[model samples]
Target: MTTLPIYQLDAFTSHLFAGNPAAVVPLEQWLPDETMQLIALENNLSETAFFVPVENGDADFHIRWFTPTVEVPLCGHATLASAFTIFNQLGFAGDEIRLQSKSGILTARRDGEAIVLNFPVQPIVPGTASDAILAALSQEKPQEVFKVVSRDTDYVLVYESDKTVRDMKPDMSALGALADRGVIVTAPSDSDDCDMVSRYFLPALGINEDPVTGYMHCVVAPYWAGKTGKASLIGYQASARGGFIECTVEGERVHLKGRAVLYMKGEIYLP
Candidate 1:
C-alpha cells in the first residue's frame, strides 16, 4: 500500500471545533487528479489541501484545494492550515511560506501567534440578483448584490444587518441549482468587536454552509473597508462553529490573520 501522511486541522480559530476543518496532505510529487478528488471525497471536509515542494524557486510549495465535489481556484483557511503544517509539523526553516496556486503565488507569514495570509483582493462589482439566488437564500431582500469574477463566479448578497446574515436558512437544493460556485452573505456587524459579519454557502461545491471562510473575506474586507474608511478591520463569521478574522486591505492585496489548531494526524493508505 502507498501510504501518505494526513492532518486535520481547525483553521481560523485556536479552539478545537470552532473553525473550519481542513485536511492537509504533503506529497513529494503530484498525484493523479482523480486520485486527489477521491481523497478529498473521503476526507469530506470543507477543503483538502495538497502540496508539493517547489524546486529552488520563490515559492516553497505548489498547492491545490479540493472540496468533495470539485476543485476550487483559491481557499484561505486551508492555505493558512497548510502553512501551519509546514511551519509547526514539517519544520520549515523560513518565516515566510509561499505557495504557487491556480490563483497565483500566495504568501503566509507569522504575526505574533497568528498567521497572516497575503491574497489577491477579489473586487466586487454591481450585479443583478437572479430569482434562483433569491429562492435559494429565502431571506429578506438583499440591499444589493455583487459579482466576484474569479475562476468561477460567486454571488455576494449584502443584507441590512448582521442578524439577517446570521438568521439565514438557505435552501441547499435550490442553491445547488444556481449557475455559480457559491453565495456569500454579509452585513454590517452590530457588535463592537467587528466591522462586518458573514456566512458562506456553496451547496454546489458540497458545502451547505462553511464556517470561517477566508476566501469570502478576501472580497468582504475591501467592500467593508471602502464603506467604513478603514484599512484594517475585524470580521466575524456567524456560523455555528464561529471564527474571527483580522482583515487589512492594502492596495490590491488582502491580508487575513487568524489562528489554527491541529485536530488529528493519521496516514492514508492507497495503492
Candidate 2:
C-alpha cells in the first residue's frame, strides 16, 4: 500500500472557496499514468496536480496536471496550490519553490501572504480562424485571433464586447472539436475594475468551461499589456466561479501573483 498526501486548496484567493480549487497529490515516486488518471477522475475537480522529486535537484520536482480526461501542459492554480502545500504544510523552509513541468521550469515565491509565479510568457501571435470556428463559440467572431508557439498551442479569441464574452452559450461539443489545444474567449474589462477579463471554455480538452483559469493569462496579460503599454495589469477570470490575479509581463516571463487558502488536507491510502 502507498500512502499519499493530498491537499485541496483555493488558489488565487485568500478566502476558502473563493478561488479555483485544486487537489494536490505529492508523491515520493511517480505513479503509473493510468492510476494517476483514475485518481484525478475520482477526485473530479477542475484539476489534480501530481508531484515527484527531480533526480538531481534537491529543491525541485517534476509536476504534471490532469483534467478528468487528459493531461494539461500548464496549469496555474494547481501549481500555486502545490507550492502553498509545500511551503506552509510540508515543513519546508523556503521563500521560493521550483517545479520542472511539461511547459518548462516554473518558479513560485512567497510575496507577503500571496504567491507570485514567474512562468514563461506565451505571447499571442495574431491570426485568424474559420467562420465555423466562430460558429462553434456561439458568439460574435473575434476581431482577431492570437496564437502562441508554446506547447499549450492555444488560440486566444478577442471578442467585441464583455457581454458577448460571457453570454455566448458556446456549443461545447463543436468547440471541443477544435484542432488546437482549445480556444480562449476574452474581452476588455467593461467596468473600471480591472485591466481586462476572460472566460475559458475548452470543450475539446474535456473541459466544457473552466471556472477560474490563471493559465490563460500566459497570453492575455502580455497581449493586453502591449495594447495598454503597461507592463502590469489586474485580471479577473470571469467564470461563474470567478477569481482575480495581479500580473506583470516582463521580457520573456509573466509574473502572476495571487493568494491561496487550504481547503482540505487528508491522506491518500492506495489499496
Candidate 3:
C-alpha cells in the first residue's frame, strides 16, 4: 500500500466551519483521473485539489481540482487551501508558489496571515437569462444578468439588495437543467465592512451552494469595480457557513486574499 498525506482546510476564513472546505492531497505522481474523481466523490466537499511537484519549471507544482461529479478548470478556494497545505503542512520554504493548471499558471503568495491568489479575471457580457431562469432563482426580478461564458458559469444575477440574495431558495432541479454550470447571485452589501454579498449555486456540479467561492468572485470583483469605481473591495458570501473575500482588480488579473485554517490532517492509505 502507498500512503499519501491529506489535509482538509477551510479557505477564505480564519476560523473553522466558516469558509469553503477543500481537501488537499500532495502526491509524488498523479493518480489516474478515475481515482482522483473517486477520491473527490468520497471527500464530498465543494472541491478537492491534488498536486505533484514539478522538477523543472517556474511553476512549483501541477495542480488540478475536482468536484465530486466532475473535474473543474479552475477553483480558487481549493488552490488557496492547497497552497496553505504546502506552506504550513508540507514544509514548503518559499513565500511564493506557482501552480500549473488547466486554467493556466496560478500564483499564490504569503501576505501577512493570509494567502493571496493571483487569478485570471473572467470577463462578463450581457446575458440572455430566460424567464425560466428568472423564476428558478427568485420570485422577485433581478436587476440584471451577466454571462461568464468561458467558465461554463452561465449567469451572474444582480439582485437589488443583500437580503434578496440571502433569501433566495433556488430550484436546484431547474438550475441543473440549465445549459450552463451554475449561477451566481450578488448584491451590494448591507454592511459597511463589505462592498458586496453573494451566493453561488452549482447544482450540476454537485454543489448546491458553495459557502465561499473565490473563483466566482473573480468574475464579480471586476464587474463591481466597473460599477462602483473601486479597484479594491471586500465581498461576503452569505452562505450557511459564511466567509469573506478581499478582492483587487488589476489589469487582467484579480487578486483574491483570504485566510485558511487547517481542519483535518491524516495519511491516506491508497491501494
List candidate 3 segments past 4 Å from native: none
Instruction: Kindly report which residue pairs in candidate 2 clash with one another.
Output: 176-204
144 Cα displacement, candidate 3 (Å): 1.3
RMSD for all candidates, in order, please. Answer: 1.1, 1.8, 1.1
| Reference-based lDDT, each prediction | 0.91, 0.84, 0.92
Off by over 4 Å in 2: 151-153, 178-180
What is candidate 1's lDDT per residue for 122-202, written digit by digit as tens?
A: 988889778878877865789999999783478898999898888888888888878467889999999999999999888
Report model 2's TM-score to 2 decimal places: 0.93
| Residues 129-167, model 2: lDDT tens digits | 778778888646678887666743577888878888868
Report the lDDT tens digits of candidate 3 across residue range 1-271: 9888889999999998889999999999999999999999999999999999999987999999999999988899999999999998888998999999998999999999999999999888887788998898889898988899676456899988899998899999998887468899999998899999999998887888999998899999998999999999999998999998999999999999999999999988888
